[model samples]
Target: RHPGWPARLGPLLVPVGRVALRPPRLLDGGAWSHVRTRDRAHLERWEPTSTVDWADRNTVLAWPGQWGALRGMARRGQALPFVITVDDELAGQVTIGNIVRGALRSAWIGYWVAGDRVRGGVASVAVALATDHAFNVAGLHRLEATVRPENAPSLRVLQKLGFREEGLFRRYLDVDGAWRDHLCFAITTEDAPEGLVARLIGSGRAQRP
Candidate 1:
């Protein structure tokens, strides 16, 4: 584990309005499974194809192993995996992965909200909170995200949070099977001196559930 990992990055709850981000708990399996199954079709287009059936009973039963692996990564300071909550109910997830220290203090952010929760600023608030934590608490200098051109909603989320378009990566990731091109977006601590969540709220764009 990294120094002060527990004290600095241990289980945390960041809340704003009706939205919150917290570590995924093993006990959340049933709720998480329910939401994922409900949003499978809504999410599959943007996500990589999975061999494991989300609706399968065994998948939900595997929560302990999955959660344990993620927890291990968190302990090693390699990732921050959080479940998005609305009014204390599980809504989706936001993850900060590929953490690199040394001279390059950076990571990548990814998130998904329940289909019913889309376009309601739930993703924006969850992402903004994650970004703030990545920059301020995680001590990361830069955060990046990638989105398919057709993913207008995701692009809007990045735009609203002020992520600058860096460039395009041809066939960057395998989504739903085939390699897909993605536009890279990034933000740095210097880019938001006032902090992302604060700026978002001040812009009168922060919507509560």
Candidate 2:
């Protein structure tokens, strides 16, 4: 079950077993280090922090504590932070930051796969799973994700997951060093009539996963 501040939610999730979700653990540090090292180059253009960001002795040491706190908030669904696992190994992280509820329940989805796992289809799987949770478990109507204009891989994943290109957000994020432009993508519960990935691919915008 998702661990968070609130005890429970009435609806918003379904059991997608096999690639089950779990709380992040201390043992993840070693996995994280490996991913960090592998993804440093691939992520250089899109991510704000780089190899230098983690290579520093100090920052690497502090990440666990900060990550733990954030992870906790995510598990409870108070915040949406999930570490993807394939065969019980840490593959990447997906987080729904800046959640806003009430009449309009929405959050922004952000994710990055470990360099080692880039082409294995994990990103699409994880995004779909998270999107399902956001709609069914979190009771959210909208799920949005953004990617750098040049990041074709990420764009493919979002499109594959049934997220539509809503628009382009210029200078949306500060990555590596400079502010970057991004293509905005979104998926509402209504858009996933044939399932997230299926609908996206069926609509002729995304590749089949």
Candidate 3:
């Protein structure tokens, strides 16, 4: 049987310059919605086709429940859903999902930055933090991320964090309404010392928050 979910999760904080990562909150709905609404086109170009009806008011109202489910997942140690904040403003989100413990000890990572934050190193910082949390705090042996071959920005993020290219998966995921090929990238605990965050900061790719 799976572990029972807890009522709450302990605070998980990661700071980088004016950027910080924390669990999602209900109060973030408006800001989250705004970012998504504004960046829908920008995001869809590289993201999977989301079934969630972004234009529906009902869907907007369901933010709390959606966030609640993420918290539940975190409590059960199955996932970590975090929001990236820059100077107290919501910039993006990163999630480590499909966590498998036992022998595999791995998970898949995904993320998106608000259109305004793109190319500004927000995704890089967020990825670094997520990678650190996955290998250090979560105690996972490995973390993987898949990106479309044309997604230069995301590919750069993975490369900066030392995720090696594993191979291409043909029709790996349904993205932007089509089954698309993806380039797999992965990093294991043995890949870096002091975690990816320290490496990023030390390399001057990101500033310490």
Q: Pick the candidate with the highest lDDT.
A: 1
**Scored by Cα lDDT, where does model 1 land?**
0.80
lDDT per residue, candidate 3, 1-209, as tens digits?
A: 23322222212233433666788888988888888878777777777666865455224576788798888888778888888887778888888888899999999999988787677677777778777767766778998999999998899889988999999999999988899999999989888978776787678766643
Ranking by lDDT: 1, 3, 2
* TM-score for all models, in order of appearance: 0.89, 0.78, 0.87
Question: Which sections of candidate 2 miss by over 4 Å?
Answer: 1-20, 49-52, 57-60, 75-78, 197-209
Better of 2 and 3 by TM-score: 3
Best-to-worst TM-score order: 1, 3, 2
lDDT tens readout by residue for model 1, 1-209: 65323322212222333778788888998887777777878887898756765566335777788788878988989988888887688888888888999999988999999887777778888888888888877789999999999999999999999999999999999887789999999999999989887877688766333
Candidate 1, poorest ten consecutive residues by summed lDDT? 7-16
Supply candidate 2's per-residue lDDT for 4. 36
Model 2: residue 14 alpha-carbon error in angstroms: 19
Q: What shift in Å separates residue 52 of candidate 3 from its native position after superposition?
A: 4.9
RMSD in angstroms, all models?
A: 3.5, 5.6, 3.8
lDDT of each: 0.80, 0.66, 0.77
Clashes of 3: 3
Worst 10 residues of 3 by lDDT: 4-13
